[model samples]
Target: MTRQRYHHGDLRRALLSAAAEAIAESGVNSLSMRDLARRAGVSHAAPGHHFADKAGLLTALATDGFQQLAKALGTSRLASNSLLELGVTYLRFALAHRGTFEVMFRTDLYHAADPDLLAARQRAADALYAGMADLPDAPAVASEEVREVALAAWSMVHGFATLWLSGAFPDSAAEDPVEAARVILGRVFTLHAGVIPSPEAS
Candidate 1:
């Protein structure tokens, strides 16, 4: 049977929507353009119009992920915001878009050299780096230390999200991943001028 486009006439959106659902159901490595077309109720060749190939579709998804992540990181940001908030927000974004979040970092799955992808990636990185100002003892405009702390913060949240989504934490040990993430991040990082009990004390 032949498939047809959505009545709203947004084939690209429809295909991307289907791809996201498919990725969530399976994974990026398992996503197929033909499968996406079928899910979107479009003809087999319909997805080809907006994307050249599977790489093209994945590239689009990765790009979208980065742009949205940047926005997420930028939301209600302030010098008063703690590393805990930033890290929590990062985890939230990851949990919300598990599939795109997965593909955004795994360059092996998509075209890492794509110009748009590179720009969007940088935007997301910049957003993450924005959290540097929250470091308690970092010097003002400390570019090197900011970069280091930013890397540490990113690593902390990234690692926590990866593990939580993998079901590494058992329900008996810790049921709420977000709270667990907050508690863990709270111990490791703090905001400027904000005081919290040391991890050892908690």
Candidate 2:
């Protein structure tokens, strides 16, 4: 039987959603406009009307990923364990949207300077900074100091997520990535927060 053609009112949304699924299942390198068109049941040329090229499509996906990440980070609260909670949320977002997360950081795959991508990225960054500033014991620090801490925290969480996704952990301790991430991230940030962590605990 012939596949039903895409005749929806919002082809843009449909194409984006399809592209996301395609990337998640096949990785960013395998995503293509033609494949997305077929996935969405639209003519191969239909994607062109919405996205000029694959770069445009991936740029849009990256923009969407950052916006969603900002929301995830924004709503994450600091119960007594501030860094652990915030870092967990960051890891969750990456693991949940593995495809978009992969494309969002690979500057070589997408237009890194796209205006929408920049705005979304800024919001995500701002959310992290705000999360750091809200820590209970966090002092009345300079913005620069807060910025430095935020960058470090982001690096640590991003590194953990990237490494976990790459299966870089060993079984003796990494039998569970989530638990391992929580312990590893909590310990590392606890140290950064001026608490002397016992290496054995880590």
Candidate 3:
């Protein structure tokens, strides 16, 4: 019998990449350390060295998801752009990275309280808000105020993505999720006093 070596090139990243695909195809509930190791062509214990247990692996996955999301949302555009574009991007990420998106928000599985995980999550959220803060229509308020706005923005996009992913949205919506998300989120972004004002309201 041949023994597998632990010293593998980019083992952590390899495992994460494979796990992401597995989670995308089969929910995290279907993922196992041994299965991941087999997919990675490594020993079962190899994953433990990087992630102590299932929760640990999930934490790492969530952390990485946050980092990637932050990067995607962090791109700087015009000096005074609309957050609607950022919202579109967020929805796009969820569609593109379905697996990571699922784990990142599923607090039931991943430990949101873990310091490392918490910090990563916060950083990702902060990155999104920071982009919003630079928007032309950004409210002139405290950080928390902007955060609230960010949350509202996030909810619209996240909701649209979730519905789309779950196939709850009609096939017509899938025909153009981005445009659909944009229209739905545009209303949420611009609506006020239970009414979406005309462009002349500015």
Quote each prediction's TM-score.
Answer: 0.84, 0.86, 0.83
Candidate 3 at 5: error in angstroms? 10
After superposing all C-alphas onto the true structure, candidate 2 shows an RMSD in angstroms of 3.6
- Against the unseen true structure, what C-alpha lDDT does each candidate score? 0.77, 0.79, 0.77
TM-score winner, 2 or 3: 2
1-202: candidate 1 lDDT, tens digit per residue: 2233455467887777778788888988799988998887777888878999998888999999899988888873554355677788889888888888878888887899999999998998888787566544432455667887778778978999988877786772556778887777776665422355555567
- Record all residue pairs in model 1 with backbone atoms less than 3 Å apart, i.e. clashing: none
Number of the top candidate by TM-score?
2
Off by over 4 Å in 1: 1-9, 134-141, 172-174, 190-202
Poorest lDDT segment (10 consecutive residues) of candidate 3: 1-10
The residue-level lDDT of candidate 2 at 10 comes to 72
Q: State residue 115's C-alpha deviation in candidate 1, in Å.
A: 0.9
- For candidate 2, list the clashing residue pairs, or say none: none
Tens digits of lDDT, candidate 2, 20-135:
88978988878888898788777888888878999998888899999999988888853443667788899989888888888888889889988889999999988888846668
Over 4 Å off, model 2: 1-8, 78-81, 137-142, 172-174, 197-202
Stronger candidate by lDDT (2 vs 3): 2
Q: Which stretches of candidate 3 lie over 4 Å from their true place?
A: 1-9, 76-80, 131-134, 137-144, 172-174, 192-202
